[model samples]
Target chain A: MDPYALKKLNQCRRERRAALLVTDLGDGRDRVVVEGDPVSGLLGEAVEKAFRSDKSATVEVDGRTFFLNVHLPPPRLVMIGAVHISQALAPMARMAGFDVHIIDPRTAFASPERFSGVRLDAEWPEEALARSPLDAYCALAALTHDPKIDDPALMAALEAGCFYVGALGSRKTHAKRVERLTAAGVPSSAIERVHAPIGLAIGAASPPEIAVAVLAEIIEALRSRGLEARKGEAA
Target chain B: MPEEVQSEPLDPLMTAEDWMKAGKDVAIATVVETWGSAPRPVGSHLVIDGEGHFEGSVSGGCVEGAVVAEATDVLSDGKPRMLEFGVADETAWEVGLSCGGRIKVYVERLG
Candidate 1:
């Protein structure tokens, strides 16, 4: 690998982007290919497959072997509420290997002691998300039950195409949210994507159980997102 | 954050850059292919400095010594080579991987 390639790869890792290192075994020449960079031909198809599968492979392209090294950023869980469910969800999501972040403007709920070892931001979603910004690889769950806090984050998550967008509420409360989001001009298609009532319907009555349900749903969202995600991005 | 994402403090590629900046001739060994339960996945890195200091693993500490020795040659010659390891070593031609797996590691001098 070139020194510049290594630096670029590390930069991709830090900035939460995907990158592919393509090495031409025949000539010993290498270059870094970042997400969405176009390469036409059989090599481009192979590159797309490598990125989708998140796998590295040695391919015999054009009778000369090439090594494709795929680097995918870790999927992150950005919960837009520091409520009891988030307290439980934070650590559970971390244990399940999702980069977890919690945002709540309510400083009392976003206390360090309450959510130790978690990235807790006592700022509104608009301010905090501006710094970290959600992406397609993120799962956003709004659980504050307060529209003042959760609405902006939900709108941002919907626009960002977060893989999982869940909101905690009853059918009635969610209906009101839908109306508000529609009035705010969020696309009806995107607004419909939010998983109202959050979590899997596993009869999760308690906070921790709800956390488990939400994490399971997040995992499902990530794993089941196949070619459709790329198509969505391309569209 | 990369530490948590990497799950390890040392990333071989980053270390290779650091070693190069400190004026060391560096060789990088990458697992380009693996079959049947290879300990490390393909694309895993084991970067070796000219003095034989290494900061990653292409296998479960199985063939690294051999790779480092070969990397020493690669560092001196500035040539890249692919090394294949199987289950056992018979002729000093192939090393053992104890886990009954096979892997192809590509070693190259990085500039």
Candidate 2:
């Protein structure tokens, strides 16, 4: 019921991260975790109380402990080809919880009608990616087999340090890609990070099957990124 | 409009952090060691709060039930437990960890 606690709770809620608002009640005898509406939730007698800043605050009702926090994560995923595989993969990625974007210069392919529920950017890769802004949490995949389109976009993805940079290609295509990347001055190790011939070996032969494989590989990379974060914490 | 629920699934590491911060007593079961063809890789985490609430996975639902029981014990007793599941063991197939690979899980009641 203190003025400071109420102000702090509102501030933290605006930030979308959760924190505890501890306060001293009138009796000054014991501390209780308050739940429900902040204004009406506190008991008149209890002196000390605490609750999470998020609307759903963590409060110990009776003997049970409550865990609550407002959830907000970074927005990340940009697909550099409006191909069929991308169509399948985009929805799957969205379901897995990513802010998905599909980019291609071809208006026919990158139209809203083609991707009804997805964000479609009808622009060339270089321009589109500049607006999307890839970061470590982001994952970039080039589903277009055309070298002119996918190659340059992949270059941008690598430069941005995207956690996962994948491209769909055959063994021969990847070989040519290696040569082109080397000639472009991209380090061999950086090129190695590209999941060329993208996706896990699910023997994927169709667009849908390939989409599953590609997403599986993306998940794998995401998991590895998580592992690195844990290791950093322990260290 | 129900503001589009942000779709990012719980990052396994963030979930682990949440477990520790709650002071609820928690255990982390990790696939520390793995052989070929494992469904989940080494470092895959299955975090369990003392109350049996959990996030993440160590294997495809195969060993989760058994691990949850073991984790429950670990949290109550505040000790560590090591578990192994693989095709070589009789119960491995029953638990789904026997999908042609072996994995060693270390369940530590983290501070």
Which candidate leads in TM-score?
A: 1
Indicate the worst ten consecutive residues by lDDT in candidate 2 chain A: A23-32
Candidate 2 per-residue C-alpha lDDT over A68-114 given as tens digits, one digit per residue, 9 for 90 to 100: 22222343577888989888988898878677878888888887777
State TM-scores per candidate: 0.92, 0.50
The positional error of residue A98 in candidate 2, measured at the CA in angstroms, is 1.5
TM-score of chain A of 2: 0.68
DockQ of 1: 0.48
Over 4 Å off in model 2, which ranges? A1-72, A229-235, B1-111
Instruction: Give the range where candidate 1 chain B is weakest over 10 consecutive residues by summed lDDT.
Output: B1-10
Q: Per-residue CA lDDT of candidate 2, range B1-111, in tens?
A: 112333455655456565555656767676656777778765467888878888999988888888999998877776667788888887854775646878777676655
**Tens-digit lDDT track of model 1 for B18-67:** 89899999999999998888999999999999899999999998899999
List the candidate 1 regions with Cα displacement exceeding 4 Å: A230-235, B1-8, B88-95
